[model samples]
Target: MEDPNPCERAKKWLQSLQKIENMNKIDPREAPISLDSSNIYEGFVFRGLQIDQLQEGRALCTFKVPPRLVDGNGIWPARVIMSLVDNVCAAAIMTCDKPVKVSVDYNLSYFSTAKTHDEIEIDARVLGHKGGLSTVVVDMRNKITGQLVAQARQSMHNLGGLTVTPRSKM
Candidate 1:
């Protein structure tokens, strides 16, 4: 009562600091990701693709496509579709920590096409993870019709990348 133990005081201080950090940190569990309005994905009202469930080393991510995500060919660009898929696959690998790894190889398939206003769902699973390489399965679908528009696999290297570098002209 007269004097607190130095060790006990240090531990209590640490716990309080941790609680404050948790309160200040973003809770992706309850809220949408906070992307700046000027971000590329935000350029078109990007929606959150979240992992709704997981089992047996696999996870499922459900997404509702926005009305504005489109491409030049007038078809939903494979790149955009892949972007959603990548988010899901990486999210699975990142089930623990987002800073753990980056996507390296992403393979996709387009069984059908979508209009600019069409809604899509992306489902992904983990095939395996070895030596810093993660293999995942992803599927794209029409949100309303429930049609399977695409099935694909994504491979990601364990290296971490906050953003991928775009290819440039030679």
Candidate 2:
């Protein structure tokens, strides 16, 4: 059953994220990017997503596979998976409190396909860091059976000192 209290849900999610960050020794300043209506995560939220887990170099997002994102044969398309990879990779990087990065390269491999309305989980992690580049790996799976759906590797270029933030809080 779902928790009726938004506060309770937020608390549980925060605790999980905190535990993972502590275990991995991630920077305290890093935080999970929210699914604001104006953000890309809003797309996932519109499709019925739930943040299952998150931490430095790792994240677990669960959602019901929407038929609209699938092909005629009911197979989840590569494009959608690619977008997921990009977003999850960004989330993984967001755990570091570093400057925003832009994806320069993405290598994705598909192992299987998911059906419409399937409960699936996408897990992503920062695999390594070198100089101004970051490498991330992502995997999609069946939430119920833990079957692999797809795997992806993405590399992003850190903008570093070139990044610009809002002048003040909203």
Candidate 3:
């Protein structure tokens, strides 16, 4: 069963991210990133992602391709894969004591396809952080076969001083 309170869950997620930063001995001068639990779209997209490990500027997760995300051909679509890559990369970046950043550039390569219910291992690592920009590389592989499904390199920029307000439900 899902948690009844979204804010509570968000708090736990934030704590976990902070723990990773602390474990890595991140500079105390840097500000920690905050999660917006009210972002329902992100919540939906990241629904079943299970974090297997987290460290400073890196994250590992496991996921199973769900039926709802598969196309009529029983393969996961490119769009969904892109969404997963983007969000997972962001989560990995957040572990490094940085404020929320928006993707400014993205490059993705698809090597193989994942079918419905296929177990996948996702690994994301931040390559660098310079000024207000951060870059991350992500790889998705089939758990059993170890075949690469997709790889993504993403660049994100901090939206300095800008506060994002959640949209009101229609």
TM-score of each: 0.58, 0.67, 0.73
Cα lDDT tens digits, model 1, 50-76, are 445654444555555544556665577
lDDT of candidates 1 onward, in order:
0.57, 0.68, 0.76
Best model number under lDDT: 3
- Ranked by TM-score, the better of candidates 2 and 3 is 3
Question: Weakest 10 consecutive residues, lDDT, candidate 2?
Answer: 14-23
Instruction: Pull out the clashing pairs in model 2.
Output: none
Q: What tens-digit string does per-residue lDDT give for candidate 2 at 1-170?
A: 76334333333433433233222343446534433333333343334556776665676788688877788999777777776667667767766544447898999998888889888888888888888898988888898888998898999988765865659665
Candidate 2: what lDDT? 0.68
Candidate 2: segments with Cα more than 4 A from true spot: 1-46, 161-170
Error of 3 at 141 (Å): 0.4
Q: Give Cα distance to truth, residue 59, candidate 3, Å.
A: 0.7
lDDT of 1 at 37: 31
Let me know the TM-score candidate 3 reaches against the reference structure: 0.73
Candidate 1, position 61, lDDT: 50
lDDT of 3 by residue, 10-32 (tens): 33563444232222444445524
Residue pairs with colliding backbones in model 3 are none
Q: At residue 94, what lDDT does model 2 achieve? A: 64
Q: Largest TM-score belongs to which candidate?
A: 3
